[model samples]
Target: MSTSDPYVDLRSRAFAIAYQMLGSVGEAEDVMQEAFLRLHRTQRDGETIASPRAYIATLVTRLAIDQWRSARARREQYVGEWLPEPLAADPSPGEHAETADSLSLAVLVLLETLTPQQRAAFLLREVFDYPYTEVAEIIGTDVDTTRHLVARARRRVRERRPRYHATRQQQRRLAGRFFAAVEHGDLPALEELLAQDVAMHGDGGGRVPALGRPLNGRQPVARVLAAMAPLLARAGGVRFDLTKVNGQPGALVFDTRGLLVAVMALDITDGHIQTIHSIVNPDKLQHFGRVGNLGDLVRADPDPTGDA
Candidate 1:
């Protein structure tokens, strides 16, 4: 990919829109490829595009909307909790603090509650900072209708959004302590780090065992994590690497063979962990790296004692 390549210049912006809209890296990349192909075909046909950037944005948004409609049904039928694919934190052009927040796994989960059109309108206006007139044009709706869509989506997001915001340093420090506790099975330390109302959501996608419902409150979440830590350690070959997921503090779990087993994203706020999102579904982990067979690993013989 040459820096001078037009697609190279537009990839970041186009992917930001598509990924936020669909919450699936694979699907967003598909939309981006299709958009680029369309742009190329149009140029070959001697059609003039006044603004290639805007045209690609519109193409990606509309395509993502269509993809989301189809994906929603599959999600409804999904065996276990559905979560957006975990995104590795990589700096990209035009990605400011606000843009990163909107890309967080927590916000993506809230965006799932929105209708396709509402999600598109809201993201364009709120996250990407697109004007109302341009948003209406992109979504093929009247300005008034677009406003209504954004308004409804905004209200819903506001109601569910995290009330406390943590600076990056605060998040990293808190998350470090949280993961350290989990690894050492320190129940008290874990409890101290978690918020009173903290919740933990796991997405195993029915391929592996996971909590069928979210575990709420500090005590329950702490106990479950503490118990599991020793079990994982005894199983052998399990390692945890701290990294950023969707611009927030997170950790990646790998098996004995160093294949990815899970991606955990911590929602830290006000110096405590507000929520914990663990993605164990292999399908979702594929985008991050080689996914280990979590089921097989869990089924293997346990060391009976926490030994290497």
Candidate 2:
């Protein structure tokens, strides 16, 4: 509300841009504040900038890109698995409401595989609807180059996407069945629900002895479930509460103390789970604050006795 700055409009735009790029509220705030500080410092020094809004956006994008690179290295060294922290509410709906219709946790996780430039381009163009010329300016690349980047990025993402769509109610019902299988160690039921070519990718960051690579095929996925049985057994019990991630149905796992320990997201196609993504790395979990009262998802407590 301060009128001291002539570029007030630019500040608001910068914040929206940062939030969309980082997808973390805390991180977005940091980027926005830093960009503004830089702007103030430049003005104080009597430096002139053309299009302050664009300049601020460029700075924020650069910062986000750098963070993405550093995060990639850390994720590479992470423990058991890497899952994008489930948002208490969908971050995508605000800025990315349109493309968000098809958003999935599995897809966001796949985004981690893209380079920072590609990620920025895809988000700017697909999510923000930025034109190619503007996208090029923000990314510091030519328009042709930007176009190619977006195309390639989209193609790669499409290749990894599974074919599936289910109503929220149906999803909830299937999720219940999924947890039941895991709780009882019912491999047959698990296999039945999983696609024949099921793929499970755990981002353990090489910290925990996890399935470092994508586990493909029904047999391999089944083996993964088998391997985790002992761990789940040792934990005594687990509870799957529904939550939102990138605006899609996600599962939040908590321990007896109600402290969140892990989150799982699935990609279902034709009533079958094609992909199961589990995020257990504590560092990643930090971004996702406590799963606020999920109401009925918690009330049902399919395995409340901790013996499911």
Best by lDDT: 1
Candidate 1: the clashing residue pairs are: none
What digit string (tens of lDDT, one per residue) describes model 2 on residues 242-267? 76655555677776558676667777
What's model 2's lDDT at 56? 83
**Pairs of residues clashing in candidate 2:** 78-205, 79-207, 79-208, 80-204, 81-203, 81-204, 82-203
TM per prediction: 0.93, 0.73
Q: What's the lDDT for all of these models?
A: 0.85, 0.68
In model 2, state the lDDT of residue 258: 80
User: What is the per-residue lDDT of model 1 for residues 1-308, given as tens digits with 9 covering 90 to 100?
Assistant: 65587567688889889999998999999999999999999999999999998899899999999999999989999876788998878446566666878878899999999999999999999988999999999999999999999999999999998654887777778888888888888999999999999998888888777767778999888888887775676678477888889877999988899899889998887788998998888888888768886666655532211221
Model 1 bad stretches (over 4 Å):
1-4, 90-93, 300-308
- Give me the runs in candidate 2 sitting further than 4 Å from their true place: 1-29, 39-56, 73-83, 91-98, 101-103, 206-209, 226-234, 289-308
